[model samples]
Target: MKSSVRAVLGLAGGALAGLALMAASASAQTIAITDGRILTGSGIIENGTVIIRDGRIAAVGASVPVPAGAEVISAAGRVVAPGFVAVDSGLGGNEVSSQPEANDLRQSSNSISAAFDLSWGLDPWSITLPVARLGGVTRAIVVPSHPGSSGGHDHNHDFAGLGASGHHEPGLFAGQAAVIHLAEGTEIIVQPRVAMVAPFGNAGANVAGGARGALYTLLRETFAEVRLYARNRAAYDRGDVRALSLSRADLEALVPVVEGRMPLIVTVHKANDILMALRIAREENIRLILDGAEEGWMVADQIAAANVPVLLNALANLPGSFERRASSLENAARLHAAGVLIAIKGNEGSVHRAREARYNAGNAVAHGLPYEAGIAALTVNPARIFGQQQRFGAIAPGLEADVVIWSGDPLEPLSQPVAIYIRGVAQPLYSRGLELRDRYRPGQQPGLPPAYRN
Candidate 1:
């Protein structure tokens, strides 16, 4: 009897495994997008074809032959572009702002600083991810926030710590940021520890001491300690090295930054603070990406000269603080005009509002940014910024097949995606909200409850 039961169970397991393999094979099938207004890295193709095979773009041009038995998706009379990339997103971490346990974007009671990786507890199954994906955001750079940061889901808010909480220990650095594909599955992390986030300007000042000078001094000292710890790890482990402000794990995390292997994303808004961050990057010989640079337009020439990219909310125009007194809606346009690489965030990096980023890009175009550059800001620019240009930035050959076919102009507020593909696999545009709307809509069957109607 035992042998008979085991045989039945074995057959069932094998059948399940075979089904999984079949599903994967279907996802990897060749798909050809035909006759679309293709947006490529080089330029736009009025009528072109993109052939996707095995989860990668096989060929893209004006005339590409589709393979036999390949799935044909007609994008005629539509705009076909690379999926949008949302930077400094809180997705996969902050599901609900009110649910503290659900929000993994900040570690309020932790001893670690730079070593606090956001990818450790990322929840790829978060309901908010599908909504963002529905808005054509196939990729995102998920960043952790400081303990005392405000503005709810907004990444443009101040990233300052409350400084020495009695209940918990907070560190100078917020944490590491990660890049993730907004596709379904547990393995969503494209790159972990892509950048080290540090508070700068007012936020840094509050965390370090009461002044900006103290903040810079503390950073230099901390970096120096990182070098020392890296050079004499054995001695430090033996307690023979000098005492350091940050923990050993933090030092290890910053080694990549100090060694120029990773970029340090500093949250600074003021023009002078932006220059200071630039100077520090130059002095320390580290790569820099400015985040929340609300006043970056004021010193656009300097930022352009340094070739540092600026990430900001395109709609940030009001003087929210003294640092952003010179904020303007044209900040993105001016920065792009000054020859600086810029990535615009919509809804201030709100996870639930990520779809608004395309609208923000449209607004940027309305405020003097070129139309082509606006699209680049959402797609190729962010990918290049984080060293994923060859992986999935553009609708180019050999890149991951992350494409979006829009019903109309993608930048327009009324435009929507008719079909979306991520890594060659078609994704459903449905979300929990849409499900509820359909379930509880008028004219639904009255015999069953809304939950049972579906």
Candidate 2:
């Protein structure tokens, strides 16, 4: 009886091991995309064929031979380009508001806190992901919105809230912003905080007592404090009298921005605000990227001279306020023509509205932005600005295969991405919006009753 029991136990263990091996072997299959109008970004391929293997582009040319036994995605008569990279987007997770528990993009009144990582706030399977993916946006820089004071003790007597650069409920004294891939598995998609955000507009003035002079003074003083902290690091560490008790978190966060290693993405739109931001960048020798440059055309020459880039919203043609009077569909084109590198961003509120990206590019093209240049604004330019140009932003050998096969000219409003490959794997094209459309359309099968469907 004992011998028989031992034999049975051994057989069970062997079966378990066999099952594990089979599961491991059943990995995602490889595919090859071929015969299409490939926009390599560096140039164009009229009859191009791209070979994808192991989730990367193996070869890309007019005559790349297709491999036997590999799945072939024929792209004849279609447009193929690198998946779009949105330089700034808010699609990864929810943007929480007044309710602290509901928000993950800003903190309250804590100072000296650069340890906040945006990945912690990321929801990998957000319903918005597929909407953006199917529309050709494969990656984005998820940024935190400006924090508002929640009746807490103000950090500076004049300022009501601390504004750090992160993607969660950061205290007004929060730290840097992290780059995130808009895909499953958050761990595999994190790039450490690459920049620290600083607000500089009417909002800044309001927080600084409605005086532009006071606002500038506060900014300068903050930098001075950071400089002092850097100089007396050792003394501060050793608790010496010479060491200041100023918590270095805010100052420390500015180190990368001040050193020009990371950019200061200032959120400003008016001409005065743009000038002030440009002056700050020059004075500090920090790289600057202007976000929401609604009136950027007014200062195009100055921006070009400074070699600064602008992130603009293509659809914000209407003038919502005096500061945005110069906003137009042609602003991006004018900036590009004046030698200012321009990247198009979506509305700050919805990052998954990528279906409008190509349309935005089309509008710019119609307004005199070169067609290819407009395409680059949505693809390669953003990737270059975010430091992923080599692997993303283009279709080429040795690059990650984040290719989008479109049904027609990508810039046309009617065009749609038939298939999207992220890291060489075709992602599911379904989105919550599409599911709702199918369920509610006049004649479609009723998966659920009216109330539940709606």
Candidate 3:
């Protein structure tokens, strides 16, 4: 009798598992976007068609034949482009500011710990996701905030701490960054950790004895130690007889960074910080990318000569910091004209700013940057930086189907993505901001009374 009951339970479980598999299979269907003004992002395509099957772009061209019975989105008179990639923004997994437990971004007190992964900090359901998505941002490099010692100071130990200890510690935020696809499920969308971040600007100086010299010294010493660590890794791994007892956490955390496997993303706004960062990059033979380069226009030639790309905020024309004295609305265009590969980032620390990414790109075009290049900066350039160009950047064959259909030119202020695709699946455009507008503003649908519709 016991065996009979056990057999019945096993059969029921199997049936449920089979049903789940079927449901998943049904969700993964072939979709094709037809009859659109497709901006392939390699360039423009007039009245083009994109065929997607099983979440990958099957074909993209004016003459590509559409398959029968395929789900088609008629995008006539609409603009289609590869979804935008926000290089630097605090989007997903960073809600609930008062709750430090909810924010998983920065680490304080120490410097070196590369094993800290940012994927664990990501909140797949954050309200910020839809806000960015509505503006056509489909992927982002979710970076951690700078550790308290921004200028390369050692507050406690050199390497911040072990990943296990940092992961469990409370009230401290500092760790690694992870790339994420702005998709629904948290489990399947995480990309690999691509870079290790270091704060190297005025903030870094504040943390390092209020001196730029201290920050530079600390950074140099940290990298030197990392170089030694890499040289001795095999010996340490093998438990060699003369393995040195080194507890340098900063150096240890930079093993991947020093080897060029991971790029070092430095936060710097001033020309001096940019030059200093360039010196470090050349001296260490390490890969580097500059973030928050508000004054990058001042030394565009130098940056381009060094082959270091920049991520800049397009709408931040107000002079907030001394380093950004030359900050202008046309900074993006100027940098592009100087041959610097530009990636336009929305303003950090606020959700409202992210919604203006398209406007930011448009402003760049209005100044001097070509319209196509401006669009590519927001889309392909960022994807290339994050190492997802093949999958996420352009509308090409065999790429993930992350396409945005805009009501008009994407850069225009009134433009909005009417339809957005994430891995060939349609996503809802509803967000907290939109919901509030519907609830409070008088007029459409179930809003306030007719008298308030004015």
Q: What does candidate 2's lDDT look like per residue over 177-272, in tens digits? A: 666655445453547576666556765565555666766786676566667777777876776634332345555676676568877777677888
Candidate structures ordered by TM-score, highest first: 1, 2, 3
Clashes of 1: 0
> What lDDT tens digits, residue by residue, belong to model 3 across residues 182-253?
766655345756777766777666544457887787667656756767787776567662432224454465
Q: Which candidate number would show the highest TM-score if scored against the true structure?
A: 1
lDDT of 1: 0.80
> Residue 46 in model 2: shift from native, Å?
1.1
Candidate-wise lDDT, in order? 0.80, 0.67, 0.69
TM-score of each: 0.90, 0.82, 0.82
What ranking emerges by lDDT with the best candidate at the front? 1, 3, 2
RMSD of each: 8.3, 10.1, 10.3
Please, what are the lDDT tens digits per residue for candidate 1 over residues 206-263? Answer: 7675589978998888889889998999999899997777777788999999999999
